[model samples]
Target: IKDFLIKNKITFIEDETNNNEKFTRNRIRKNIIPVLNASIAGGLGKFKRFFENTDSVLMLFDFLIEDRLNIMKSKNPIILDISKILYYNNKLRKNLLYYILSKNLFVDSSLIESIDRVISSKRPNIIFKEKGMIIEKSYNDLKIEREAGDEFDKEDFLKPGMETLFNGYTLKITKTVFIESLLKKKNVFVFPLSAGRRFKIRTLQTSDSFVPFGMNKEKKVSRFLMDNKISLSERRRVPLILNEKDEILAVGSLRRTGLYRMKKQKGCLCIYVGKN
Candidate 1:
């Protein structure tokens, strides 16, 4: 390219740093390239061919990994069965982990090794936290999630028939005379009519404690979240439904407080949780 440009008498600006030996890249280009070419026949051509082949292999590897991830995603969007990673060779396994995690955070070899160790342990409810990201393994399932950070502190109040958005979830409270027996607890919270029609929607707190729905004994909110396999950072984002007294009525789309359990009631208060 340089010879062609000179032969045509074309003028082009050049960066002066290319000739500076103080930089490692400049030293490699000015010093190492000539030495390698002089030491072996067709050395430059060989090196170029090697790099081209390596890039092709890497592209194919990435495609295969992506195909596997897409199949896993089709089964479940949140939790992934990562046990299959154990079947891959160490280098390939680490590279695949790096590829998957790099989508969420800046990952290095050391971080990948640490996560690999955690996965190999096969212990139930193992969690590895680093740089605002949590890599959790619950038996065979894996969860990679970012820490809620300051976003968890954002709170709002919910009223009957009024929809409010909080942390990517849409919540609406309503009083209903008819109780739906098949309500999915993961998306809706049903409480007794006495629990109040209006509630505050906020993330979990350190001091929060309540008797989770279907339980008699009171438990710390932190412990309850951990029991559900929620990581420390993720627990901060789990919405808690509270009444006028600031008492927790439910863990929001999770389990409701036993205090609000409807027992032969004519009507019930329902809070529907949906993703925006």
Candidate 2:
């Protein structure tokens, strides 16, 4: 290539860094390539050919990846289904993530461990950090998003049918005919927001305890959250619906206080929490 450039009168400046022995490529060019010229099996032409083949192979892998994968961006943390992610083996999984995240960001090795743990255990809401971004595993869904730069609403207390935008989701309470079916609306509970300061929704405290709806024993908020597999990062954001007397009503996406459950009551207000 150097001879060809000279013959064609194509002017080019040399990067003097190539002569620096401290750099790997510079040492390779100065020592290894010169030694290869005296050997029968090793030479610059052979090494260049090998790299050409490697480039071709990488191009083919790129095409295969484009065909098998697609990312869903409509969700807050863009979601990548586990079926697509796990389709590749360990090596290809690394390649796919590198491609998806691009070269600018650096993904930690722990990400592969996170994926393997989720796949093997089949646990939901598994959270891990990748390049300062949060990657969440919820069953078959893999959610990837950057860390929130701003704080989530510190406190949100809303009436039934009212919605509050918090963190990355919109939490809305609605009065409905048990959206999850009357028999299965486990987390739904009635809490009158008209009580004003008497009723509030805030983050759970360490000492918080409540008899989850239908259960006789009161459980500590921390124990309940841990048993639910809620990640530490998310537990901090979990809202606790409370009464003026500091009674726990609901623990957001977990269980709620039984004080307001419909049970066999004929005509009582029921609240359903929906997030999207």
- Scored by TM-score, the top model is 1
Task: Give lDDT tens digits, candidate 2, residues 113-231.
Answer: 55455644556668876544677778777776665645654564555434454554445554333223544555455543332233456776778888887788888988989998999
How do the predictions measure up, each by TM-score?
0.43, 0.38
Q: Give the range where candidate 1 is weakest over 10 consecutive residues by summed lDDT.
A: 68-77
Each candidate: what lDDT? 0.68, 0.59
Cα RMSD (angstroms) for every candidate in the order listed:
19.0, 20.5
Across residues 32-118, which tens digit of lDDT does each residue of candidate 1 receive? 467556643566777656457654445544444555334134221234556666655577668778765553344568878887887
Looking at model 2, residue 34 earns an lDDT score of: 63
Best of the candidates, lDDT: 1
Off by over 4 Å in 1: 1-150, 180-186
Which residues of candidate 2, in runs, are more than 4 Å off?
1-150, 174-187, 190-198
- The alpha-carbon lDDT assigned to residue 133 of candidate 2 equals 67
